[model samples]
Target: MSAAEELEAGGAPTNFDAMVKDMVRLALSSEYARVPIRRADISNKVLGERGSKQFKVVFEQAQRELKRRFGMEMVELPAREKLTITQRRAAQKTEKPSTSSKSWVLSTTLPQAYRIPSILSPAKAPSSKAESTYTALYSFAIAVISLNGGSLAEQKLERYLARMNVDTQTPLGKTDKFLQRVCKEGYLVRTREVDGGEEIIEYTVGPRGKVEVGSGSVAGLVREVYGFGQEIGDSDLEDDGEGGIRPTQVEQSVKKDFEMRLRRTLGMQPLRDRRAADANGVDAGAGAGADENEGRRRSSRRPAAQSESDESD
Candidate 1:
């Protein structure tokens, strides 16, 4: 503490505040004393037990300086208080993250326009009966494929949605509708299961579906088996470099014309999985045969040694 400051304070015992005042003066005197606030330095470790509260003081002082120098307020949000899709969509219309105290949004601008013409126009209304039928059929398709380990099932789907805290039942129905429309327009081929009791149908990803779903430049089953890049149009689809687009789109962007153009060139023929299973079986058999032959050779060798010993005796 400064002697002058002590005298001004009527000789009150010197405290850390006086020390901070001195440091501030020194910092002001030296241009090299200025430094960007390192987030790590403000952590508890560097601050020490008694000094733990020092960061808060430094932070407040920095905040005061910033406000004074720029005439602006600093805004920060906790991780969980981040943005939502609907909120993001609404914000994007103005080309800005929402300044609402309730919203802490992130923004991304698109580099190109790959808009398909039909998706831009309003879709024709289908009869309710047709919608229900399509929904049921597609749901069945999803369930069946998922049951065979082709994709995630109901349980996984529910868990995923819950983690994201997204309950878009109406939007989910739209996904079913989009899948159904693909099934209708694309050259989907159905084949009987190897067991013959029921058929397992695999939908071939056509060219239109490729443009709609696949992240790659090529079309067909590759896209269905693989996936597309992120940031299609204005929103983000979960791209795992595989076909399952994440955070399913609320609207179907690929039109019937594009969907129809995709040819069903794969997944219709009988699956060749049996070849893999057969090869595995053959390898197991070869190993077993070698073990058995080795045992027989050892037994024969033992008998020959016994005979030779008996002759020597």
Candidate 2:
């Protein structure tokens, strides 16, 4: 039944508007710390006794208001990681992994036109270096973990950060505390394994990190750090006929190959121009000259080869 119908058939009357305001307040409170708001908290705090039967209506209405007013909406959290062997076994038994975390986090609902960095840059509200430190630590840590094939051993990760001088004197406190903060904030997930009394700790991208600072975000950081797709420090140049690297050939080689190499090194997908080329080639051979048709047929085998290469990898 609809919310109005439920209220009309009700025992005690619910203040629907008040409940929606409470839901918005609760979501905003949770979002201030970038933590998720639990469903139970909503049921108890936002819905209360009278609105319990109208929870669905109340939640949807609150979402619409959030999007309309704040340009954000509460997004349901993905399922918790199945870390233990028992959890994996249970998933296998069920033939489907668990799909919900019973929690929601506020995510931007802004239109693409308004989603640029210029429109969404941070304001001066941090008030302290430590707050900015928290942001930087998680962002770089998540990028490092993502670029390191989805997980990094604790020792290796610490070494990487240390090389960049992110140790004891970091604005956020000690290195250990920095790591603890990210783990607690759900930007990184830690797993420990014990074998022969040797404890190994590893870090992986947490669900929050994936949703916020994913591979695309990582790539954006890379492009902003280095000039877009350019090789850093040294160009991987091509040799011309005279046994010297030609700048013209170097440009073509980098254009065709450097991006793929960079993405491979960073564990990201290659640039997407190949897809556009493929799309443009749809039945294109029918209208081409004999020489062009020959080249087109030659190029057509490349996709098949690429498919096999991807499968092997």
Candidate 3:
């Protein structure tokens, strides 16, 4: 049936055109930007009920009028796709596949020379050692989150760590310790909810984690280690002339600020060469003082021996 016939059948009021126009104007206003523009939303706000035949007719008429008069079209936002249990598990597996034998060997037997500065490595001070461990764990957690589309299930995180052969037994399990520390230190945020009578935990990079992992330096490290870029959810970033993804100006500024903060937090020294220069300076100063003392004693002995020789003569 025609619009007029449908409106007549639906018993729309004589001033339906004006009312529809007003409803459309209100729906398109900035005040409704945060709330989605849907048939139900418009009906509830304008017609006082969602299931009214008059409202449906008016909604259709408004949409057609808006398009014809103002060249504006009403479009529905895309709904979020819900994944089934099998699909979710498949996605997790694809994101973090099992390590290959060759890769495992290379990672496990990698020499100290090949390790990065902020990565886990041998350190003299206990605090430095702890920092290295934390850094490694933080990097891993961020990588996992990024790989799994900016959030990781807590159980999947544990499975991924186990697959990577992270020692979970020593010192009360590094994986558990890392999770606790990251949450406490604001490097990662954990969200918990009950779904179908079961508690589920999810992890996402927190503010501190973003600062540490999103910087240019850390991005390079992540790319080198995981073969991926540092920007989270930046699958659309364009490649530069150098065969690398170019970061935006805002990203560059953020990275610079993060670098400065990291330097200050880590004692303003290179992660790989921390305190080495200070130790060398102390050793050199001590050696120089000992040499001077020895020289003075020798001169005093020489004078005393010369005086004795002259008396004997």
**lDDT, each prediction:** 0.30, 0.62, 0.46
Tell me the TM-score of model 2. Answer: 0.71
The lDDT ranking, best first, is 2, 3, 1
Model 2 Cα lDDT, one tens digit per residue, 210-234? 6555554555455556555332223
Q: How far is candidate 3 from the true structure (C-alpha RMSD, Å)?
A: 29.4
Top candidate (TM-score): 2
Question: In model 1, what are the clashing residue pairs, if there are any?
Answer: 207-262, 214-228, 215-227, 215-228, 226-242, 226-243, 227-242
Please write out the lDDT profile of model 3 over residues 58-159, one tens digit for every residue: 766766665466434443322222234654576577866533211000011122232233333334334555545555666677766755666789999889
Badly placed stretches (over 4 Å) of model 2 are 1-14, 84-87, 90-97, 116-119, 123-128, 229-249, 262-313
Residue runs of model 1 more than 4 Å from their true location after superposition: 1-168, 171-179, 187-192, 196-198, 217-313
Number of backbone-clashing residue pairs for each candidate, in the order shown: 7, 0, 1
Q: What is the alpha-carbon RMSD of candidate 2 to the true structure?
A: 12.1
Q: Model 2 misses residue 286 by how many Å? A: 30
lDDT of 1: 0.30
Clashing pairs in 3: 168-173
Q: Is candidate 1 or candidate 3 better by lDDT?
A: 3
Error of 2 at 78 (Å): 1.8
The residue-by-residue lDDT of candidate 1 on 1-313, one tens digit each, is 5443443466763443443343333323221221212334334323445655565564444334433442222222111212334445665687655443321111111111312222222222354444444333333443333224333333444454354333344333544344445444321212222334643433433222221122111222222332432212222323666666555444334422232232122121111222343466642213221111111111100111111111110
